[model samples]
Target: MLKTAGDRPYRGRLAPTPTGRLHLGHAATFLRAQERCQAADGTLIFRNEDLDPQRCRPEYAQDALDDLRWLGLRWSEGPDCGGPCGPYNQSERQPYYLEAWAKLRDAGVIYPCTRSRRELRERVAAPHEEDEEAEPLYPPEWRPAPGTGQDAQEPGEVNWRFRVPDGERISFEDELAGKQSFTAGQNFGDFLIWRRDGVPAYELSVVVDDLAMAITEVVRGADLIKSTARQLLIYRVLGAELTPRFAHCPLIRDEQGKRLAKRSDALSLRTLRERGLSPRQVQDMAR
Candidate 1:
């Protein structure tokens, strides 16, 4: 069983993808994490979610660290600090994910999903055009059955998906958004847990990491609210004690009210540094 919040020491993390340069959104989330940790007298760990090796650049990873440092953010331990979680990069933790995947496989909670992205898009779009605004479009038999590897198959041949429990509501109290819930088999159907390319899916990896790190609270952008249900399912499957408290803050939008993206904006930390923006100034802008 997973331990309750009171049963564990307070621990949080600032996990960032190194696929792009650090921007205002990144700074804002990190600042919030730092403040929250300070307020609670807890330790904040820094992790690089650089699993997408193809898009993740070494320079970008270094730049992200430099950017965080420039923002006056300090982590108690990280990849550079050589702490207990020495390898703070996700890429280095593939073995752990593999082990977790095997466990889920043995439990018969995951299944092979042959549907391609294009096929899934068409499935979702077809219902929309038909004005059938109902539940997610997944065949009943397609869902994985607990303790039965009926859908399990060789990797690279088919993608893996988690079988969500039907008619069950996965609900949690958000530190900021109050009560949030999603009907398991209805609102969300079986979802991918591993890619065909042998990469551990984010939904699975994050849950495994959070449990391993003993994180007490999770504070992220409100955009990820939908992901809560999928994550909670993983926690339940693992028989974790209790879900961590969540605080999904508002996202930083541009003048056009669009979420900021690295490709479309010149808000890279290096660019900001070149413009002579001090760490404090950047942090203030993030706020």
Candidate 2:
């Protein structure tokens, strides 16, 4: 079993996906996590989210570690530096996700999705500022029966969807953004929890990791507020009595007012450092 906060001190984490180098936006959020953990006298953990086999590369992970160190950030435990969590990388933590999948399946909360990516991409909401990439909301009319009907592919070949309650509002108090709420079937409907490729979706992976890590406080970008709401429901279903306090930090936007994406290598820490900028200068720029 994963360790809880119990008599131990608070634990925070720096979760970085190795799809790209750490950009200023990521640096800002990471700094906030480091600051909050330090304030609480907690141990900071670094969890590598190398879930995507294609996008996440080994060099990118190394560069992330290098960039973080260059930016003067330190963590008590990480993939580079081991922790009690053992396998600090998500790619290696597949069994944990599988376990959670079993629980949700037993609870009859997940169903197979038949809709293809090409179909969803054509209708999903436009990209927003520092937020989850919006997937096309599966129309209420198209939802499939739990564990039975498939969308397009063969039975187990299709994706999985978690049934979100229609017309219910998920409300929570954010430490930085204050009170927030999103109505189900309005703001978001049923979302994917597992993919057809046999990989756990970001939603499921994060919640399961957080619980397993005993994350007492989650300090991430404001973009993830909706994610917190979604994960809150997962916690409820999982019988978690104590959910972590959430702190969504302000986002770092570009001059165009759009939130930065990994594609913007010009704004990445590597580029900035290569341009002879000091760590302090980078920190100033991040703010």
* Residues 1-287 of candidate 2: C-alpha lDDT, one tens digit per residue: 12224455788889999998889999999998888888889988999999989889999999999999999899978899898886899999988987887777777777777787677766665445345476656778777666553232322566888899888888877778999899878877788888888788999998999888888888898878888878887887887877777889888888899888888899999999999999999998887
In model 1, which range of ten residues has the least summed lDDT? Answer: 126-135
* Displacement of the residue 200 alpha carbon in candidate 1, Å: 0.6
> What TM-score goes with each of the models?
0.89, 0.91
- Per-residue lDDT of 229-258 in model 1, one digit per residue for the tens? 888888877778876767887778778877
Native-to-model Cα distance after best TM-score fit, residue 29 in candidate 1, in Å:
1.0
Local distance difference test scores for all models: 0.77, 0.83
lDDT of 1: 0.77
Error of 2 at 258 (Å): 1.6
Model 2: colliding residue pairs: 114-151
Using TM-score as the measure, the top candidate is: 2
- Deviation (Å) of 141 in candidate 1: 5.8
In model 1, state the lDDT of residue 40.
Answer: 91
Best by lDDT: 2
